[model samples]
Target: MLAKFLPGARGAVLPLAILLLVVIMVVPIPAALLDIFFVTNIAISLAVLMVALNARKPLDFSAFPTVLLFTTLFRLGLNVASTRIVLVHGHEGEAAAGHVIEAFGNFLIGGDYVVGIFVFAILMIINLIVVTKGAGRVSEVSARFTLDALPGKQMAIDADLNAGLLTPDEAKARRVEVTTEADFYGSMDGSSKFVKGDAVAAMLILAANVIGGLILGPVSHGLTIAEAARAYILLAIGDALVAQLPALMLSIAAAAIVTRVSSDKDLAGQIGSQFGSPRTWTPVAGILTLLGVMPGMPHLLLLSGAAVAGFAAWKLHQIERRPPPPAPVAAVEPADQSRIGYEDVSDGMLVRLDIGYGLVPLVDERKGAPLMGRITGVRRQLSKELGFVVPQVRVVDDINLAPYTYRLVVGGVVVGEDQVSPDEMLALDTGQAVGSLRGKTAKDPTFGLDATWIAPGDADAATGAGFLVVDPGTVVATHLNHALGQNAADLLGPDEVQALLDGLKERNPQVVASLTPQPLALTTLTQILRGLLAEGISLREFRRIASAISIAAQKSPHAEDIVELIRPDLGSLIVQKLCGVREPLRVMTLEGQLEGLLGQAARADTSGRHVIEPDLGRRIVDAITRAAQPLIAEAKPFALVVQPAIRIAIRKLVKTCLPDTPVLSFFEVPEDKAVEVVAVIGASQPAQAGHFQPQALPA
Candidate 1:
């Protein structure tokens, strides 16, 4: 029934209420009406106080400033209405205005006008001097700081959005919230002035009523001086008290709101949780107990207070000491009686590490687990190199695996698994060990090298024997790092591509904006970037990539064509990272006979996946691996500089057998950098390319 009337009633209520307040100021009201309005004023003040106290933050009560303005207008209207009633009826008696006013005057102050005046003055002073002034100052400071921090907050939201941490809708919502917070604080700063002004208005209204009533009573109503003073003074004091009471409550509410920090809990909850610590309450109780035993102290009251505090502290301490409850085991419902739901099915982690129960200590921090920290370091390093944040490796216990085994999973597929004793160290034979130790034989998970799981004390002996020794934690971390790096292309999806564009837009916005989704779709960009990553190229030179791809994309939408076109421009970065700043680039070039054969085959094989015959492919891969052996052994970077036509084909073949070898073209060698041909793969060099002799290997 109320809902039926609410639709029509809502539109008229606010306007009519304002109109009534205006009428109260212009016209006189009866004693009964004054009593209703005064009680309403008190009720509204209490309601506002409760709401303010319950608010978790200033934004939670965003409409408070407007409400404050209306309440102040209402109070001033009441003040005007009450003053008129008191002056007009002063000669009648103290009860002439209303029972509420007469009760406040006679009952509250024992029928003494001077006492009532003094009491009203003290209340006004508390409101004006303390609460109102302090609240205004806080509001001002909060507003200024909020505005000052707006730009930084906006930038942080943009950064999160660009990093794919926040969706577009979430970013928009956060921006709106930031803007609203600044506006709310600014409004509060101005609204506090209304409260201060109201306090002043209340005091002025009281003085005017008292002096005017005293003069009007004797001159207009024919009352004696003592009688007029007594009647008018008591009425003035009562009116002042009624107005000042609500004003004081509002001042307190304003102070509470401006001082409140953002929190999930209300005032009472915050106080209870923050102050519940046994460590805090125990010292407080000790201080109170010591103070209670002083000679001049009131023994009974002080001792009783101390006893209550001590009991509370003890109870809190007991609660803190209680052991946490065990986690409840999930009871599986009978399959024959239960129905399957969407909740029963779930997606798996993007990257996960599952270890057996015995190896759990490798991930537990208290047990000195280093695998978790190492995985985090791997993620940080890969994020910088791969141009996207690698998702965290979710670690869990898997009862199905062997006690010393763990599996690495990517996108719910098991890519790698290994077994290692956590309490033992792996000593790897780098082909230069001078001695040997007896332990369980195994291959290194990262590089597939011969290794032995030896005792921890055997690490010194192994290292002295020229073997590289590593802990089980490093073994797992190295495997995870290599696995991620090898499959980094698979991780560069449309979301990662968009993140790259968003980051580039910050520096070169127009270039990125014009390139993405305008001429080229996000999928096309992803494919182009993934192709580059597949060849072990870093996407860190985002500006150069964006500029080159924008121009290259317009000519051909094919990812291969774009990568081929952009590679020459990014040649210096690739070469410098491999050869360093000052050293000559030591690159191995294909023999002419092999180069001619690969080029002819590449031209015939337009698809770029297949170029040489299977037999020839293996022969070429073997020859390149043989040539790169010296470079690999010396721990130096090696690249095969071939014809541009066959470079793509060679890279595809080399990536499978020799994933670390870089395949570059003559065009990709920067003109300013000097190059030295270290070895020829299939035929001897003409001796003009470099002094290093080449061994002729048939391909």
Candidate 2:
């Protein structure tokens, strides 16, 4: 009860007293001056009140009497200065030099009064700064206030609910609890609370001033006891209390308006949105202008302006608080109701219906499903109208036929469709699965070669005869047929052969270099050829032996021999074409022997024989030249064809030797005919190089 009336009542009382004083001021000269005095007094009082309220600590009054006495002295000094200036100079002209000097002296004597008023104004500005900076602090203060008061408010609400002050639903509705935004102004620093407390403090200050003046006015200023007492009471009431009332009212009104506006959720959001706009600050400017223009009672104008600004802000918030219309309710349907399936629709079928979000899956299903011929016809018709391709049809069932059951999958999960309509199942045309199987058939060398050389088949059944497993050297020799255009023996001399033998011996000397008992270093043999060519050996010999070694490596059962024989000569170009020889530089070592041979041959005569060791050199050169003839002849037409064949044969031979180990084939044969083609080529080629290119055969 006290909180409700105190603020408003205090607001009204001061204004009324000021009005009475204004009336009295019109009666005489001294009274008119009283108006100015009252205004300054009020301004000072309000400033002090604001400072006290905004301060971090509570006001201390232990020395209040001394402060009051000092304030009295200050006011008296100011009054003397004013009187001297007015009396000595008069309104129209400058006073005598002596009189002006005396007035200046009086002004100096009254300096304390002027300083006090300036100090009060400075305090008010400080208060404003504190409120602005400590916005969070203000909120904390408000929260504390609310918490202290909540229990009583909650109890009141509970009592109302129990007393049937509301219906069951209304009681359950619960009071709309206030949040920080609702309780505090957007300032967030608790400025509203500070303002409220300042207004109350202003009223108390006014009351104190009135009482103090009445008691002390006679002693300080020259006046009769009764007149002094009357003047003091009037000064206190009119200047302090009366002038401050409007400011208090404005502060309370502003706080209430802000609270109400913020209580509306939509309004609060609008305030946030509009806060950045230029229009939001217009009210603040207007209020400040009013405060500046208004004289003695400026606090009234300032407070009124604040109140109006708050009200205007509330109005702005209201504009954004329009009620939204309720959403239209959807009609419920029975669970057993039949719905058309997407698959049942013809290819060209046009569908239009009101459906829920759940129905989208069915539409997607229809788009993916295969369509039958009848459905295809429908699709064509629809396509003509829609100017788009209709879904193709693949299968259809007449009414008398048994229903075809198909699985429906959504997101990879399969579902069963029972009694599905023809329209539900779309027909689709997919290409023939068999036509896609076209490929080259590889030869099965195991079927024709001697069983003793071939590893036994996985099942050991007497299903067919076993064939010999081609050596890596033999496979290489066969492929060399195209590159060398001659027998492998003719291209490889005793020296070249001896070099390969030495490299193979390094790994395992026990193994012999033959088609059946493939050397352990067949891979090294190929590597040596590759190296020789890289070292400037004429490709004539290297090409033949490398190709042959590749073929042999493909079929060699011995994995190590396959690797060593091919490792040397797998130079850049050949390695790239073969696909698996990754290191071109590493393969370069294989050509070392070939390079030595060329050096030996370059020094030889037209017969291609070296000068030194004429017989042995002659034999080596002749063998190489003869072996190179077939490869050189066929290279232009069959280079691509033969190299890969050699590589394939080598891969197969390697697989046969290491029956328990895995061998990766370099040939990229088609999936269907891979085994058949490999077998045919391996069997057709002889284990000896001279068989295919007889001219290059060793004598």
TM-scores for every predicted model: 0.79, 0.20
| 571-591 per-residue lDDT for model 1 (tens digits) | 997898788778889988888
- Per-residue accuracy of model 2 over 19-117 as CA lDDT, tens digit each: 544444333334344445535544654554443333322212112223323333334333333333333222222121123223322343342323433
TM-score of 1: 0.79
Clashes of 1: 0
Provide the overall lDDT of each model, using Cα atoms, as 2-decimal numbers.
Answer: 0.86, 0.36
Error of 2 at 306 (Å): 37
RMSD of each: 5.2, 31.2
Evaluated with lDDT, which candidate comes out highest? 1
Error of 2 at 13 (Å): 33
